[model samples]
Target chain A: MKGIAKKIQASEVETLRLRLTEAEEALQAIAKGSVDALVVGGPRGPVVSTLAGAQEPYRLVVERMHEGALTLGEDRRILYSNRHFAHLLGYPVAHLVGKPVANFVAPEDAARLADLLDHGAKQPASRELKFRRRDGSATPALVGVGSLTLDQTPALLLIITDLTAQKHSEELAAAERFARSILEQATEAVVVCNADGRITKASFAAERLLDKPLEGKLLADAVPMEVELPAEAHHSGVRMSSREVLELVLERHSLRGAEAQICLPRLHEKHFLLSAGPLSDEPGGCIGCIFTLTEITDRKRAETQQTMLVAELNHRVKNILAIVQSVAWQTLSANHSPSEFKRAFDGRLRALSLAHDILTQGRWGHVDFEQLVERSLAPYHGGDHGMRAQWSGSRLSLPPNMVVPLSMVLHELSTNAAKYGAFSVEHGRVNIAWRSDGVNVLFTWTETNGPPVKGEIKAGFGSKLISRVVSYDLLGTADLDFDREGFRCALTFPVPKLRTDALRPLSAAPSPVH
Target chain B: MKKNAEDLSGYNLRLYIAGQTPKSIAALSNLRGLCEKYLSGRYRLDVVDVMADPALAQRDEIIAIPTLVRCVPEPIKRIIGDLGNSDRVLTRLGIDVSAKV
Candidate 1:
């Protein structure tokens, strides 16, 4: 009994020492003013005594938190709410408690809250939904729900985070992506550069058009060494260095915007319409400049060609008028009466028009010699008798420059034949033939069965045109033989070598000009 | 009249707050409620907004926000927070500890 009592006494001392240490710790905690709370068994159950420091921090956090916090009962009723939670719903904290949690949820999202609450009971879940406020407005929020115990009863903790700022940033990123896609697919070359003239972005067209990688390179260096500004562009007074030009553009963009045209000679003499504008942030501060280059080479070439064609047409028209004036003067000087002059002038004009028509049909390239001869004699081929003229020649074509003078000579010879030498009477007939001996063509015109010609034909406009103009223009010689039975003419000229490769004779003869 | 003079010369309290933040506003309101029920006209309260006059914070040796300091009535004491627990705050201020609000 003595040993057992000694053992019991030792155990009692150990328990008392433990109690003493606990009392000392409690006293220290109270003296230091760090004791947060004390829980004691009361007659009712248990009562909590909260310290000022502990409760103040929790209240401050609830009042100042950016996110709203709420406690909900198992029945989905609001059991407790912090000041932020009440502020989020535009209600007082006292008013929020005991209210159905669905009152603050949007009507559509309220139905889903039941499922969310059930899921939250098992495990935590997060959802994005809109919440209805006391003021009849809705706000987008990301709500996180987790299970917890409130006053020893099962409850749900809801943390709602506003999504306004996040949504705005996402929309901005989408807009940036859209702008980038447009630049990538654009036909014109586009380059974006920073204030220092360093290229920040280059479009696909810029890579192909500049024929060099543009990104990270200075705008000045992207310009090929061979490219020089045209006189017009220089006169526009953008005569600075390429780097300076970029700087000027960037500076102007900061104020407003600027534009200039640049010529890229290395890219097949391409002309570029360069337009530079500033890239500004939302606050209207310029960050960089965007340079857009559009190739106008084809358009520029067309304009130059049009100018040349107009000048050429003017020169040709003036020469044609001079020729007509000379023809009128010659015809007036030879004829004694206005009627005679009118007849000669009219005939010459007709001849000129016929030559022009043939040239036009050939695209002003060349006229067939055989067709010219036949057309000149077609008017005289008519009559009660069949055609009293016969002709034969090797096929040949003449350039446009030679067609007019040649046509006039042929017309004069035909007129002289009809009036005096051949075809003057009903039984008169004419035979014409030509042959090329490689270097020269020999032509003969023989008149038969007609009244004999006089001793010498007067030096009229027709005869003068036939001899002087034919010889001078064709570089050939012509002689008329006033034979008693008929008048015969012989002509000789150098035949141009046949350009068999570039041109071919028409396969079929032209239709007769009746 | 002697009792009124003694009450007029009672506790001098200064509350340091940072702006009109929710914690500061709650602290000010709760402190007023506590003073009205306990100290009443017997205490002088000086509310200092640090955001408006930041220099006052350094002068008071304030380390935390919403600090209530008892400057007069001898042996100055400080209580930090929104003064939500009236019993603790009243006891720390040498006032009736059993005061309820």
Candidate 2:
């Protein structure tokens, strides 16, 4: 019986030792986190419970999180991914695991992620990168990376946030800033007023023109002008104060834009063309009134000047027509037949027209004396006249008043020379020249190689025009010497100081001709 | 089919949900609480996520989320919403449940 007890005691000792070894192995497994569950005795019975890692409760928490959570193995292969992370890439959670993390990273950001993983994850690092989706599209994301241990193996933990909505808002804000800057730089004065007619915003131009900061001031006080509404507004008896007009524009929801002219007497008698429109929000609801003021003072002045000039031109044209009518009547009375009247009237009209052409070419300012002489003699030469006229004079300019009468005198002398004097024959020649003696100009005309002159020529209209017109209209004296050999004339005119003072200096020495 | 005694003594209920939405989670917890209080040891509950098994939702004729169907109650009854009010849920499911302690 003692021997049987000793054998039983040995068997019990071995069994206890084996049980203790198994318990130690279980404790080590628990410490290492490799066991999924544990069983312990409770008051009622034995309880079986799972470790937190093996439970689905934490998985639910991760799945419901807004940010994407993922784990990557040391080789950068996805070890685990929550639903949000998979959804960010447009993929199923099951399809994401075991894939290379670089496959979901944009090509440009893959290198950065690879380098980060190569460093084996120390402190948490975050980067803004584009993440490629399963559909071959990309989305901007902010990814935070850190090192973690999964099943005793080093891995990377990533938290991803979608930047699509955030980036969109940022871009919208930037566009708004750009538009505001453009408005600030606009040349037109821009003012924004609220429903109360108080200025909410004013551009730099508006502030400068108003000579005060216009923001927060009443629109009427800022502009201080009498507004002229459209004619239709007048007929409708919608005469409105400046403030009331602004309010009316805002209230007229269907009317988008309106314009009026404002006269600001206190501000340098300035005229501003004010254009008002409702500033609309994104939903197309009117928020406030936007008024733009464009200064029309200079334009108004130019318009007034144009009106006065037109009226003055009308008066002058009527006077000129009367003078032409008198000239036609007088020339007709002097001539006997229709052909004679036509010839004489046409010649005189051409002379007047030639003078007007010179004045017009000079912008109706002053006619150059040399230019007048060359033009008046041009038609008389280079035909049967054979370039027989010679002219020499100091450079001079004539006032508009002197151009017409002087051209007429020159015209009558040339016609007479062609009909009876120097130009009547092939070898006949005429010499016309002038010189200024500081205050008066002495002009002389000589005809040579022409028919002999009568002893005393009758004072016909041509001679009367030459002798009377040049002296009376030019404020000068004239003489005619019809010698038996040729005809000669001399005239002296007081050179107006204004004309001499306004003369442009001669560009070069005059070529000698006589 | 003739009703068996065992089948009549128990309730078979199915809850249709979509993912881990807050409403679906609340409905699930509320249903669990109601089952424990009113039909403990006499009810069988199955939670189906429509996002995971959409075909089940079509088969069950579920139009809206967080719907509970009592399948084995002879006349099938469907309840919608988060089931936050326990009394309302119990009444809607035709079960007499006392308030929880």
Candidate with maximal lDDT = 2
- TM-scores of the candidates, chain A only: 0.67, 0.55
TM-score of 2: 0.52
| Predicted structure 2: clash tally | 0
Question: lDDT per residue, candidate 1, A174-234, as tens digits?
Answer: 9978878987899988888888888888888989877888889988877532223334543
**What TM-score would every model get versus the actual structure?**
0.60, 0.52
Instruction: Give the poorly placed runs of model 1, Cα more than 4 Å off.
Output: A1-141, A145-157, A161-169, A225-244, A253-266, A382-395, A423-446, A490-514, B1-101
DockQ of each: 0.04, 0.02
Residue B17, model 1: Cα distance from true site in angstroms = 12
- Regions of model 2 farther than 4 Å from truth: A1-172, A184-187, A195-272, A280-287, A295-320, A381-387, A426-429, A433-450, A466-514, B1-101
Q: Worst lDDT window (10 residues) for model 2 chain B?
A: B92-101
Candidate 1, DockQ to 2 decimals? 0.04
Sliding window of 10 residues with minimal summed lDDT for model 2 chain A: A505-514
